[model samples]
Target chain A: MDERSLPDANLPPFEGGRSLLLGGAAAGAAGLLLTLIGGFIAPKAALYSYLIAFDYWLGLSLGALALVMAHNVAGARWNVVIRRLGETIAAAVPLFIVLFVPLLLGARYVWIWIDPPQELAKETLRLLQYKKPYLNFNFFLARAVIYFVVWSALALLLRAWSVRQDESGEALLTRRQRKLSAPGLVLLILTATFASFDWLMSLQPAWFSTIFGLYVFTGGFVGSLALLCLIVTGLRSGDSALGKIISADHQHNLGKLLLAFVCFWAYMAFSQYMLIWAGNLPDEVTWIVARSRGVWRPVGILILLGHFLVPFFLLLSRDLKRSRQGLAAVAAWMLVIHYIDLYWIVMPASSLDGLGLHWTHLTAFIGVGGASVAAAVFLLRGVRPLPVRDPYLEDSLRYVQP
Target chain B: MKRYVLGEFGEPEDCVEALRKLHEAGVQGLDAYSPYPLHGSDEALELPRSKVPLVALTGGVFGALGGYVMQAWMNGVDFAINVGNRPPHGFWTNIPITFESGVLLSVLSIFFSAIFYFFALPRPYHPVFESEQFRTASLDAFWVSIETEEEEPVADLEEKLRSTGARRVHTVVESA
Candidate 1:
């Protein structure tokens, strides 16, 4: 079949990106400043928690972009409607380059392996020193840079390929994407696992769980879904290039993705908790002890409620599944709970001795969240909302979730 | 002789209008194919109900059963490698992988079923390929094809097409 590539007329006006850029910048600055200040006023632990939250939030943003690239390269039909949202989320990858500065600076504060010579048993020091070859500050920065570089390259290639398809009508672009997906998925998993270990789990180096990376995967995957749904809801209201073909099936499929990830996250969280609890190991249990305890207990319970319960129920209804507004609300809640979920997982590492609340928590959240999101929005506003030349643009237009 | 008319479509509405006219003109058994699925084209052509979903569903059910039987046989009876206290059949632990396989199988089943059911893949060299409009169907072209047995010859098809909204009607011999 001669695939005459179709022209795209349905994108947001080029001029509109200006305001989104400005809003993103303003909001990002505000969020980052608030997060920083909140961290500063809090106890030392609160600072670590904020830093952790910042790391995860930024990480998922990058992860989302990576997911988009993969789906594009894979040329999978199911994800066509939401893939643009993922791509836009990915466009925020540069923000993570900047966002990691806090994580890098806080390596000493968060990671036991950082100050190798300080307070460690002979055996522990030996381990830290042995890891020094790969664990040193310089190497960490280099790896971070490499991840960003690889990520940005993939994102650009995927987005470029998609846009070119719009005008070129090369069906082979889809084949190219399919060829790239396996490698892309492998890269995504490796980077995500290492990042989880480095940014979240490494803070308390003594603790280890083989599945730690999968936990992050669960959250990142679900978070991406929530973000995708929310973005699509917003796009449905706006003049994104995809305005023509969005439908109930698309939203329903998004809902199903959201549901699957939600369930996956629960399963992972349960497996992690149950295994440690059953084994009753000191090293592994310390993380859970703080998490499952008194002041922190409510937070854990809240994570269960908001992260699992609310979204599950909200997404359960087929009616809600098909409606953009309903899914959008659920997506927004999921996003907020995602932050809270990260907070519960990471904050308790610091907050275990007692309930640690400080203004720094809010300030840092605002500082980082405000700045990162604003920057993401700013960057997103700079580009056309949808890839106009995507070879699959027409396919995406006709894509129903079913 | 069996009749067919083809037209170029600059806009989606043109295609829709063409479809509605053809349908009303009694162009039964007519089909339209485009580079992408057209919005409102379904109603315009008044095409017969699609069995693709049911075919896909049947494929999924078969896939799920295959997954279950495959995993069960592997872990339960085929090579039941016992590990300490866990049961010989580690069915619980096997569930995730099993689920993934089920999903994977279902997808493959749907894809292949879609191909065979629609006869889209393996590229059939149907007689309809003779029409230039038929060639454009893979690109920007929209067309309505009705065999002589389904409707009267050319004029009847053209009048019906022109009335509802055919941009043009051209005869096509099935591309042998």
Candidate 2:
């Protein structure tokens, strides 16, 4: 249980991180350049693809922030080993603020109300007029700035305090973090909820689901957990001391959590659909109608199977949950399905009739994802992979599944 | 009549280690008792993995299928009530109940199977209970009990238990 017992190599600025940062940056540069070029060719599709990619990466960062805050607020010890990973991901929020510029510039293209087309239905035009107070471009930009500012402050403060604790080993720092996280979680969830309303829900301005925010949040959180699984398993494959401390028991717990959240995301998705289905109202049913048409129908079914059913059953086995390879594979699959889930959400608004598959989708994903990875690794540089000075670090390391 | 040799250890680890050693020694009919579940006790005792999950899965799948069929028959075929011009057997409406039934059956199977089959509850008596000091198995003590027939050698088993760090070793006979 002693900190001295662990190998000194657990301290960061390692060889793997350097290569990871460089690789991520190079991929980011290439992807962004490609996305830019693709934008000029098919401006509308490119904008939508860029939005999907942007939302996917931003959700991950915000979800990581939420997880770290939840861990601190709840005094969870099992995840203390992976706390820094969450912090590193959360630290990418500032980078996302810069990434938001492209989406902001093309907001009109992605959102219908920003500049409603002349052929928009009379009913929809009236609805947009009524929603004008909340859906205007300037207000939308302002809200985006506020969201990033709040997220940046929360993520940076938590990371700074945690890193300071590594050097000073201040127990007060832990209590201070718990206190900050208590209010921080509430604020974060509220802003995130409203942000989902602004970015995703507004895509279908005529339609609204009260649970859309929760649905988005749940999907993102599940994705973040999947990312954690991959990173933990990936690190174990290497010689990182951080990976050495994590036992299969920890992975099993994480797998259990991933399953739980997967179900939660499904539940939220179903709840939204069921309510709208039962009401059979024009405002609500139109959203579902748009999605169920053409190739989108198959995409919806794919989401159901890939996102929930597959992961649920796979993670149920004790053997799979305990094995690094099994859990990591499911995690990776979940990440792919998560992108599809986002694409399904954002792309439907772009092209209601078809899949609207674009080359920019892949490029924008690489652009955002690679840059996010680079930023996370950069923040992680020179920092201990785990909170070595944490009082509960030993408890986490020695945790046995009961 | 069958005789049982029971070893009581002060520590769970020692008890589990003794179980492992006894298993390695090729001793049969082994079980461990403690106030709380001990980690690695399953492996130490070399017990096969529990089949409750299998039972639960079977129960859940059947339950879900039955739930969907019940709804389909009642709404779509049997009663055939028309509501709101939607499909008579609404897939969306059927889902919640299907899920609930699956969970319900899974829980029922797990609970019943565990009590009636796995734990073999309601018998009320075990040979290990013949030793008055063995009562601590459910309190503060960790116990490993080995069941044997009347013809097997008991003295060597008692000796083995004492050598394996058992604080209070006792032999008990079933009264028929």
Candidate 3:
């Protein structure tokens, strides 16, 4: 078929539905109200739950940023149809910075080593003292600000160049994006790693995993891919322009990527466990011991089954990957599992009873997740869903699996 | 003896077009050989989806169960031994090796099934090789073959093949 005959090439810009944005905003506001009520009722639980939600959503946004940059750096053509959606997702980085304010205010309730309680044992206090330079509040805030600035600038620059390409159709902009993506990716990895370390890992100042940063990154990457799949698949319904341009072959490719990252996440999770088990050091072993015994044990097993084995087996079939409903089902399952995975990571540290689930977990998740989706949808308004003028758009539209 | 009509093309697109035309003309027993897999050519030929993946899945399940059972029988029934005071049938600890064996057997099944079942390998001779043009099917050409009863008109089929874009067409006969 000739490329020009395809009606997708002349697709108009997406004018996002007002109801979708308004619905998202309403849900977000309701969640925020619940979070506030939960905070007043139980400040400590609310703070910890908020942190979990914060880290989960942040992982998704940054993960999308990294993927977008990766697509640019590799000059990949298969993703051009959905590339603008990724940019829109990445544009939520600034909104996350604003959300972080509550976490900053509530830090004292979550971080044990922040003020070093007067009742702390001699050994723990000594351990915390040794970690003082890195764990101080001032340094933590500064690092966070730096991470946001770097991520926001990169996302905005790439998005600006993409929008410019729509009007000018300058092939040079492609070269410029390709050039910027290389360093942009390096900066992303560095900032994301330290940010994960400072934000989540430091919750247990005594325990550490050398691979923790990569482990967190893999979860985020997998979650982001799942989110992208869901968003694209959702838009592909309802007679949208995206529905015509995107094909089963694109879904198959995305499904393959989602499978690869699921395996990658499993590998990272296993490697961390095996290393910690082999070393048997008290600090590292404590993290695993807490989760592997009692109520937390079932949660650990759930992660193993739901997060890895089920998705791995389901995605293995070529037919399933190519089926829109099947792929969407898997993507939705992955998104839920990703939230649980983050819950497994964050909640165990603070829960006195192993595998505790407070009502605030749900409220905070909705509050933060709803607000993030609203911001992303708002960014999508008045923009072309597909990178309409990208030199590779035709290639992406015509892509067929060999 | 059975007579077969074969058409050869320099490119996959021409071969696919030829296959589509022949199928529309009510041709039966159509098959294609190409230097590389061609998109939609399988549909053009109306071939069923291959069973190689099913074979692989069965093999993987068997291998996984075999691996787990071997460990369980060894530790719990056959010759029980205690290692680090873990349970006799600790499946959690047994997962890595079980997974390894499953993947190994699945891959091996795909490899061999694709060769033996799909490709029908190990035969030293076939009538397709009687035509020299068929040799290029593995190099840079596409070939389509149709089997028909001895009474079918050969010239008409050849003309259809030529009109549909085959570079060349031939008829071959061999004893059943």
Candidate 4:
């Protein structure tokens, strides 16, 4: 709207990614091979660890997808500069469809309900039977397929339209994106909720909480926001194109949202615990009881401090959020805590006694994480770093927090 | 008696530019008024950071502590009701009320501090109201006003404001 030249939309695509892609692929292969060996030696433990790692990466990618859809629907201008990065992360959902196969092959090892133990009481068996209508393997597989299809469709369509706009520069593309995203957000939340239930909650078929989906979704969203901060700061330097576009104002805003979601995740976690603790039902209370009593208790406490309190206080500073290194440090810390959070959720059922620090956990995490990073970098190199032709790109570049 | 020299600008940008020039020239007691917030005005005015957040945090911390203690005293020690054989003081149950009171107190503190301390509002009249054209400060025009407690030469300041693009300038004297 002002008499200033806008950044050229015809800018060159991002370069210098082949080494990162190859390195990431190498790490991923090594981790996956080691995890494959763990499958033969300690099949159940390897499967559970792989599940934890799988959930961490999957949730983060979905979180990115959720944010991009929300940005489109709300027409937020502050995020327009870094919208491509989020789109790239979200666009990596198809990769998870391939990664989900290991879980499919080893479902019984991870989920007790898949092959209920013979030592179980008759009443417990009856309960499993009652849940079979919803939790059966066939329905579970169908639902997983539906969830991935829905997620990939939403993510890919949004990215395709956005990329097309780079050359077409049509206002219609923006309108079309908003149109799909408005409904896409609802579809995403529903699918994500069901996905959380199927993959994580089914680990303990007897336990149920209405708020579990929201809890998982919030944590994943927080992780993705942290990842977004790291990606922007990692890619940008004083002389880079992103550095010219993204200012400290943008980082400050991202930090504030990260802080807010950290609180929300805490709230969701606590709210679920409080209600279950109050209800004191035999079925529901057992889940919380198992988590609070054993080695998992200390892990929960760590999440309280590391995931919530420490970052909550650290990110409160106006200066740290604006600084590149400071914000990136906090982001990396949160990503680690997010993995631990998932580990705490999924590992309790598998390892009854201790924190269950296993080599496979590390290997499986590296495998999934390395592959995800490689996919993201590969996707990033294919497009312009930012949505250069977005109608609101200038607003984001000039954005100053009020 | 103090004099308030008011200048009107057709554009908020010109008004902000004039404010910066006046500030650089060491002219004190300068402020701007507009129907909407003008970007860069805070920098031009060199305003100090607001302390409302600190006040809010203090209130919230105290409120949360008070809430927790009130529950602990009333339920755990004072009456010590036995409900369903649960613990007399349930820490988990106390959290929701703790969070609510914290938020409630934070909002109350921010509202009161902003109204009475930061803004000093509820006054009905000011010397700026004497100029009918100044009413546009709230509707359309941008205004820069300088308030001096002691008499200062008015003509040079008026010339500076006009030179910087103030379309109309006038001085109002407050009767004391």
Report the CAPRI category for model 4: acceptable
RMSD of each: 8.2, 2.3, 2.9, 1.8
Q: lDDT per prediction?
A: 0.68, 0.88, 0.85, 0.88
What TM-score, over all chains together, does every model reach? 0.66, 0.95, 0.91, 0.96
Lowest summed lDDT across 10 adjacent residues in model 4 chain B is found at: B148-157
Model 2 local distance difference test score:
0.88
lDDT string, candidate 4, A302-383, tens digits: 9999999999989988888988999999999999999989988888878544877779999999999889889988888867
Candidates ranked, most accurate by DockQ first: 4, 2, 3, 1
Best by TM-score: 4
lDDT of 2 by residue, A1-402 (tens): 112244342465443578889999999989998999998898889888888888888888888899999989999998888899999999999998888888888777788899999798888898899999999999998998899999999999999999998889999999999999999999999999999999999998988888999999889999999998898888777767777777788888888889999999999999999988987997789888988878889999999999999789998899998888888999999999999998888887886346888889899999988999999999888788778788788778767898
Q: For all candidates, what are the clash counts? A: 49, 0, 0, 0
Docking class of 3: acceptable
Fraction of native A-B contacts kept, per candidate: 0.00, 0.50, 0.20, 0.30
What lDDT is reached at residue A212 by model 1?
88
Better of 3 and 4 by DockQ: 4
lDDT of 4 at B46: 90
* Stronger candidate by lDDT (2 vs 3): 2
Worst 10 residues of 4 chain A by lDDT: A1-10
How displaced is residue A268 in candidate 2, in Å?
1.0
What TM-score does candidate 3 get on C-alpha atoms?
Answer: 0.91
Model 3 chain A — which ten-residue stretch has the worst lDDT?
A: A1-10
Off by over 4 Å in 1: A1-13, A34-46, A116-134, A164-178, A238-245, A351-353, B1-176
Superposed Cα deviation of residue B65, candidate 2 (Å): 1.5
